[model samples]
Target: MKTSFDTFISEFQQTDNPDEKYTLIEQIISSLAIIPYGHKNLTKSEMIAHKVFVILRDYVIINQLRQKHAEDTSSQKVLLNVSLLFMNLCNNINETNITVFKSLFIHKPLIDELANCLHEISTHGKYLNDPSRLRSVSSLLIALQKIRKHNFTALEYSLIAPILFSVTQCLCSSYALDMIKSLERNFIQELDEVQMLFLYAMPLYVKWYWDYCDPEYFVKILRILLNDFTAWFTSCQPESYLQRSSQIDAMIRHLNYFLVRPTEFDSMNIFSEEFYDDYCKLVLHWSSILSSILACSSCTMNVKLAARTSVQILYNLTLHLNVLNFMKTIPSFILMLLKVTDLDHDEVQLNAYRCLGKIMIEADIKTMTKPSKIAAVYIAFLKDTIDDSKKTERFYSLLESLKSKFLSIVFFYD
Candidate 1:
């Protein structure tokens, strides 16, 4: 039986129309849909797969990057090539071909080279101020994102700075983040809540999967956004600035905006049956990180830092705490200061109560005069009450201490 290899190649070469090529590729892909398990032909499959991906990788703009370069936004060529190659490989092996796609990235020089190309995206955006090039860079980065299934490495972080600075400056992250979350809500199934959370960080998650994420990443961005808020507050009229603030009182307005919201999951529908059983265990590890931040917040004397950052400080503190979970930490954090290691009882009480007092109301005003005018005075008044009451008049002092706590609650809630 003579089989015509020319006939097969002829039909493929005839697909001159891009859409037709893609359609033919899809037909090839549909043939590869099967699940596999047990011992497998990884070596043979990997060898062919590597060659396929290597040929595909060749199409990846094979020039040493130069400064004035423009990023290629058209990934469909290589993307289609990989998809077609992947489907054929999968049909022969009886498994999804994601592992084969990943092997190309796992090869060291290739990873470094890919990262280097991405670095061009970063550099071009920064020095050139080319937003289109930046967008194209992101498109390529995102395709690698698909190949790696959104995974990354610590080394690629430098490549992110250009895109991050660009996107943060632009007004599109809000929309982009929401689109990512909507996809997470609908299609991201295999992940449990925790894996899903890593998935939810959107652009950031891409960095995280690659091991590029640092908790400080968010902290740095928060600081920049806070500065924007401060600058706007300083320049604009008081009523208008307050009304038009980007972050309310300098705290993250949406706690889980890019993370999981309550709707995509329910505690009753928790991904883990062990969640409730291990609730205390999870809190134990999380609280250690929380405690250190609260301590730093306590020791810092920068009044502007405290006044401006208080909302965010408390906002973060409350994050891991659902109503019940929140209550569990308070006793420890508060009671730590309340510790009777016999440090001056009155003095400790005065300091602890004072920290709690600021938790209620701290000035948001940028002007010195505003914090001093009754707004500042109200805060000082609470301090004085805590001080005097901690000393002599036991009955009056208790009453004053109670007053401060109640007053704080009123302002915080109102």
Candidate 2:
């Protein structure tokens, strides 16, 4: 007897009625759900399973071709159901079933079709009027992301950014949030080693959609993403170190907008009091991570140096904004800055001094005047840099300004 998957697809292909075809497609997907639960070990019985998926896969390609002219509701339903079935297989594939899942390779036409359908309906507001269509389209894209063998080229990945933009643009904030959660859920659960390339594509995706997404919703999405990234960074395997670092660097490049102009974001209620509260907490959290990395002796010199530089950048922003009260508690970061002040790289040294200067200008007189605190560093930094005039003017100017403030305070006290 043929496998249940084979039997269903055969009957599914015979049906010309869209409703009947949709029902059969649903049954086919329901039957495949057993693969993820480990009940169907397709690896051992790969031949039969491969046959089933190949037929199903080809059926999808043919219907996708037909779907172009399929304007009636019934035809739309059948085409959508078939598309969902393919996505379901992608999402539900596991180690045991991956061999069978590989049948989806080279389905670029079908992939493009699904993306186009999603964007066309979404851009035109079809999904908005019918919530189910929105969910189905979103679900289809989420599912397609799971197919490891269908690696998207950079050009194809670029197509994804606009689809994401269109979807988020047309949906309400609540539904947009739902769609984001589904995409994230699939990224977390459905992706495996072979599928990790998509992770690199994500930063580009976020960058493209950043300006288009509603600030309110984007910030929430960003927070969740930040938390996930931190967790990934902290527990990451060695193999992923470079990829994770690149992703973090790309993401921070965009986050600078919020860090640089909190007021602009606040005007839109993007940085409202509630978000600012969360913002302060997240800054502190990342501060601790950077400090730990800087302090860890076993870490590579390059990594430690990078972390030190990031600390300077973070403190410079926080101190200048004066938004987070907890910045004062992280005094250890001051010494890290002083240590990097002696580095060979001019920009790094400049950033270190700038950060220290900000901290000193913001510190209370007592903190500034302590023997080993700003006073001692200020004197040494100024003395050590007396001969280096290459862009050293800015450093001296900042130092002189801070010293003047500190001296005025002391003269008043005396």
TM-score per prediction, in order, is 0.31, 0.37
- lDDT per residue for candidate 1 within 2-56, as digits (tens), equals 1222333355567677556445444433332332322254325544463323533
Model 2, residue 101: what's the lDDT? 50
Separate clash counts for every candidate = 3, 0
The C-alpha local distance difference test score for the whole of candidate 2 amounts to 0.46
| Candidate 2 lDDT over residue span 225-324, tens digit each | 4344433333433322223344344334333333323232234344434445444555555555555555555546566456554654464345334443
What is the Cα-based lDDT of residue 76 in candidate 2?
Answer: 49
* Model 2 poorest ten-residue lDDT run: 186-195
Q: How large is the C-alpha RMSD of every model relative to the true structure? A: 20.8, 15.8
The TM-score measured for candidate 1 stands at: 0.31
Off by over 4 Å in 2: 1-164, 167-214, 220-269, 296-301, 312-322, 362-414
